[model samples]
Target: MEKPLAYRMRPRNLEEVVGQQHLVGPGKIINRMVAAKMLSSMILYGPPGTGKTSIASAIAGSTKYAFRMLNAATDTKKDLQIVAEEAKMSGTVILLLDEVHRLDKTKQDFLLPHLESGRIIMIGATTENPYITINPAIRSRTQIFEVKPLTEADILTAVDHALADKERGLGDYPVHMEENARLHLSRATNGDLRSALNGLELAVRSTPPEEDGTIHLTLEVIEECIQRKALTHDKDGDAHYDVISAFQKSIRGSDVDGALHYLGRLVEAGDLAIICRRLMVIGYEDIGLANPAAAARTVNAVLAAERLGLPEARIPLADCVVDLCLSPKSNSAYMALDAAIADIRAKGSGDVPDHLRDSHYKGAKDLGRGLEYQYPHNFDNAWVDQQYLPDKFKDAQYYQPKATGKYEVALGQQKNRIEQWRKESRQKPR
Candidate 1:
């Protein structure tokens, strides 16, 4: 039987690998290693189909090493032992271990000395963050490199290469692929070249030749072969941050429709906890004091979402999302805290005013703490103009409220009155 398209299209050298220019481009560390033929044990990690296995294979092919393929999930200790014995005779062996996170204690124990002895050059492949999944002892033995997701252009390059190669690809067949179909494959696989190539192969192989012996690939055929396209999201990867950022920005921009669309994607991806946390942030960071009620409702929504969970949980989330998207937006509260924090960090903290320092403890009055602290409740309007900030920041004006909506507008009036009091206090003798 013929090999799968992904296997057939696998790059035989580092130059053929399309994406991850940071690692594979000229003068890059991995590129230099492959060029020098001085290979070492390393871990290749990232989401699937980003060419972890292909990189290992390419390295073995380049150096002409005795390459062995194994899966930590399926290959047993006996399998490793056989490979180890073969390595003893071969001088050195390059073992491409797939799903290396599944490396059991037995296999790990078996390979440790071999790796240390340089008898085995292990190229471990994992989709997990190896720092979290692999044992520290085993991880310490390998250099870790992250493989990034391929862009559409990268996948397109691979697809085009597969179509033109006569030796190992479908170059012999009359493959007529539509532009839309090519774009679909390029965009829909979520940076997994294996999925794109497989989908293309399936669309070509399964479809019968036309009257003129041409196998035409259209958007419909490609979509049918690939079925539903997943949202391009890795919960731990950049896509997660990108989508969450778009969601928050949509709400802050008061784009209800856009917010809902991102919410749907998150809901589909089952990133409920991120959604919960981001929604809480949107409440305070975006809506803020402009709509305190909306922020309160969002907190309630988050609690309900945690308790209820997706499908049903989307209801409370939908309500909160609509409210937040439509609510008056402000970042004054967020900006104020950041401004205060920047001063504290860069300028260094100043002495806490004696009037403001805690003085209720035993003998606290001896330091003159709380000596002349004014009681706000004793003054009219339940307010008093005092040096609340440390003496260094006593005149600092961090909260400049925007008179945007009814809530902030009311606060703005009160703020104006407070500024008058502050001016009078600044004029008084210290």
Candidate 2:
């Protein structure tokens, strides 16, 4: 049987490849590597259908190197051995390891020697972050490059090429696809060019040609084949950042309903990691010092979500989102740091006060370092007034606790007490 439209439509050469201008455009890194046939072992990472496998194929095609493909999720150790043997005999082999994140130790052990020997030029492809998923030993051996999702224009270009390629595509059929249908295929796939082409193929091949020999592909036919509509925010696309921004702002604004709504959208898209990270950011940047308990709870929930994974993950995630939204918010710490940083940039870092310098080392007392440092533990209520900042910043205060949350309210009261202590100490003798 003929290969699927996606497989047949794979870019056979560099010029045919679409998207990832950062890597394969003229004078780009990958282009230079391919032109010189100096391809090294590397890991290609990113969302699916952005052309990891296609690029691997193109490299070998251009270099005329012995090429082999293996799916790490299914292929056995023996499969790797076969490729390794071929590579040893051929002097070099381009081994495309798909789902490389799933590569087991047994297979990795077999491939490592070949990689070190420079016999197997491995190209690892993964949808997940390789640094987090791949074993460090294997990762260190391969350079990692991310293949970003194809844009709408890139997908449209690929579709147009497929519709015109007679030998391998749908050129034999006289078809006219509607603008909406074309747009749907391009955008709905969420940058998966292979998916767009496959959907386009199914819509074209299934629809009967009209009496005039034009197989007009309407939006209805395209929708029927594709089944799912494009989401407003893609998990790995530009809209993903927007959704995260909105989710964080909603929590910061104490808008529980808005926060939950955006949280649900992200959960449905199956990106627990992104949600977990956003929760942590919200805890510190948005909820800092206002509710220490909330920040702690958010951290615990993130741990639980990661341990449980998926369906159960959403439970902890929901708890976190709700807590974060309902809790009193503050950007005091965030602003405090920014204020301190601005000072540091405007004025040079002043020298540490002599009293604050280390006095534990031998002969340090000769220089009078830490000579008059006041031990706070010896004072009343374990609080004492002393110059902790550098000489020029003796009166500088970077932290200003907000009274928005109960925790910060207590902190504000403590701040008042400390100021009173400082006043009393100034009038007293050393």
Q: Using TM-score as the measure, which candidate wins?
A: 1
Each prediction's TM-score against the native?
0.65, 0.64
lDDT of 2 at 201: 88
Instruction: Spell out the clash pairs found in candidate 1.
Output: none
Over 260-282, each residue of candidate 2 has an lDDT whose tens digit, in order, gives 99988877656676788789989
Write one digit per residue (lDDT tens) for candidate 1, span 1-430.
Answer: 9889899987787887889889878999888987887677999999899998888877777778888999999989999999899999988899999999999999999999999998899999999999999999889999999999899889999999888888988898799987767776776676889988998889889999999999998777876787633345232235655788999999999999999999999887566767898999889998898989999999999999989977799999999999999998888978999999998998789999899889899888998989899999998778888778787887788887976668998898999988888788779998
Model 1, TM vs. native: 0.65
Off by over 4 Å in 2: 104-106, 208-213, 216-220, 230-430
**RMSD, one per candidate, in order:** 9.8, 6.9
